[model samples]
Target: MAECAFDFEVLALDGTPLPLSQWRGKVLLVVNVASKCGFTPQYAGLEALWRAYGPRGLVVLGFPCDQFGHQEPGDADEIRTFCTLHYDVTFPLAAKVEVNGKGAHPLWIWLKRQKGGVLGIDAIKWNFTKFLIGRDGQVLQRHAPTDRPESLARDIEAALA
Candidate 1:
């Protein structure tokens, strides 16, 4: 695995290669998202956070995943349309990715290793799992799916500081 979060690359919603290094020195709020899950509404809150902190070197990245209940089984275009119509998301979004098992994305695997789940499990438990990344690309904190995006302002502020 790569040494830091910046050492990974994930496909953008447009299917272009997007490298994490491009956001180096910026605080990142990385989330595994879904289109149809109960926590899908968090997208709005995430967008709010992005708008609130983006000017201060904060980038909110959403990665669509279908591992949980097939919630995000849409292609890039479908996902894009859904997000636009439903949440009006403007933050960056990675293409669909697997967040568990052998098919898990490299960045995800590294993230889990940096901060495990409840009971010390590395495997993701559900969608909307959040990771706060420092400006140096180190994993700073892991938040559960139930953690609202609005609740992270202080954490983001601290990271930005």
Candidate 2:
């Protein structure tokens, strides 16, 4: 049986396994992101958060998902280039993965179980859905697709403390 967020490994954009264990004991902002979604602009805010809090033990992990509206249609390289050129995003990004359904990533499945969405819907509602994971590798909070990255600072601060 799985234990915590560290139990899973997601593929990096380069297709190598990236283990969550590597970031154990750090506050994590895990976001299911998309390139063409209306919230795509949030990438700038996310990068800002990473730049501001990364030095203080915060890690922002972006998981590209194309499930909703086929928003993230690019391959890994395309996604990488877009993020770098547009948002100047410096955070680590995972390869595209489904955020819902049977093919949903294990980490996401476990996360929904930990903190159900609004109205108790565990499945992701749309792109840009975010989850905050504490240093202990457990889900700290589940954020709506509409929630801005900057709005999460207070909760992240409490978790870091």
Candidate 3:
């Protein structure tokens, strides 16, 4: 089993392999995203965070997930187009993934094991669940789906510092 965030591998929206090790020495906000969720608007704030802190060693990674209410039923191409046209999201986006159950992505499994959910539950309750990983590849915190991206600025700043 992987001991840290950098030990995992994910797929990009284009179906390219993306190793978390490539983001060594940078703070990462890993999110399970969905295009049709009510929290979908959070993409703007996520993009803002990316643009605001990117030069300072912060990277926001979005992983489109379909496990929550089938909210992200779109395929890779459709997801890419929706994000670009609606949110103008510029941060890196991963291919559609399952964030819960046995089919969950490895990175997510590690994240849940590391931080768990509110009250120590391991299951992700909904889309937009966020995991904040430090530059050292350790998970710093897990934010609830209702937590706005902007609300995470303080912790992100601290992690970057």
Candidate 4:
């Protein structure tokens, strides 16, 4: 078994304790999301992936972030409202956080350590970056901001299988 890639807690937009451990035994797609980024529309694709694979053990977790280009300037409430009103998103969204920098969220720090992106760099370059995690809680893959959620169906299916 691979080593656990994450051990941290974050807040839900509603202030609930968002526990990474709750997702054990499920395939998780952890995304750093921004409301105003160019890739914002990816929310629709993510929702589609969730609706299609959720029952089969796929969980898409959105972590609202403003670390890139100030694209997500909203607070937790505003972020939640935008996601629900604009995309009808039913997936999990963590409270607004910094995904890079010295104060980056611990969960993100742990995630980057497990699956550094191209060239083995751990820093996130933009919003909508995706991290695929296996049922064993290990990070399996890292997809760039431009990679559509639908493109990940094959990997998700393989993990679930």
Candidate 4 local lDDT, residue 26: 91
Q: Which stretches of candidate 2 lie over 4 Å from their true place?
A: none
lDDT of 4 by residue, 1-75 (tens): 225744556888788898777877899999999999999999999999999999999999998888888899998
Clashes of each: 0, 0, 0, 0
Model 1 clash pairs?
none
| lDDT digits (tens) for residues 1-161 of candidate 3 | 79889888898999999998999999999999999999999999999999999999999999999888889999989999999999999999988888888898888888998898877789999999899999999999999999999999999999999
Pitting candidate 1 against candidate 3, the one with the higher lDDT is 1
* lDDT per residue (tens digit) for residues 43-154 in model 1: 9999999998999999999999999999998999999999999999999999899999999988998999999988988888999999999999999999999999998889
lDDT of every model, 2 decimals: 0.95, 0.92, 0.94, 0.89
Q: Which stretches in model 1 have alpha-carbon errors above 4 Å?
A: none
Better of 2 and 3 by lDDT: 3
Worst 10 residues of 4 by lDDT: 1-10
lDDT by residue (121-155, candidate 2, tens digit) is 89999998899999999998999989999999899
What TM-score goes with each of the models?
0.98, 0.98, 0.98, 0.95
Q: What ranking of all candidate models by lDDT puts the best one first?
A: 1, 3, 2, 4
Provide the RMSD of all predictions against the true structure, rounded to 1 decimal: 0.7, 0.7, 0.7, 2.0
Candidate closer to the true structure by TM-score (higher is better), 2 or 4: 2
What's the true lDDT of residue 93 in model 1? 97
